[model samples]
Target: MAITSDDVRHLAELSNLSVTEEEIEPLKKDLGAIVEYISQLDELNTEGVEPTYQCFEMENVWREDEITEFEAKRKDLLNLAPESTDNQIKVPKVL
Candidate 1:
């Protein structure tokens, strides 16, 4: 798994990075080393091991949905706003 200057250039272009001529060689060497190190995982033996999706136990803890009333009235909330119409807060148009 050797990385070349062309490969580095192409990767830079794909990632929207600006790479100079001096940086291409260094990037190629670093990327090649990373690929070689990652390829070492092929030597691991996991013949009878079960694939685990999560490291810890997870369960859905759900509660019943209930509506609770607030102490403030609708008119009180509307009055807090600088400008309101039809019991709704008025805001400036975005566009």
Candidate 2:
């Protein structure tokens, strides 16, 4: 898991990162140590352990679906907009 100067340079180029030459050695050492620590996980024994994606069970607390009628003002809805023509709201082009 020891990352060399060449490895750092290759990684930087792949990621399109402009890394100065002085920063390469420190980055390589840091990344190499991280890989070394992650590889240590292989030493753990998880035999007979059931695999689980999440720790908690998920359920949605939602209100019951019900329909109700209410009076709406058409003029109030139209007046909320700054610009309207022929009962249609006008918007500027996005693209």
lDDT of prediction 2: 0.88
- Evaluated at residue 56, the lDDT of candidate 2 is 80
* C-alpha TM-scores of all predictions: 0.48, 0.45
| Candidate 2 per-residue C-alpha lDDT over 7-59 given as tens digits, one digit per residue, 9 for 90 to 100 | 99999999999999999988988999999999997899989989897778876
For each candidate in the order shown, give its overall lDDT on alpha carbons: 0.92, 0.88
For every candidate, C-alpha RMSD to the true structure in Å: 9.8, 10.2
RMSD of 1: 9.8
What is the C-alpha local distance difference test score of candidate 1? 0.92
Stretches off by above 4 angstroms in model 1 are 46-95
Model 2, stretches more than 4 Å misplaced? 45-95
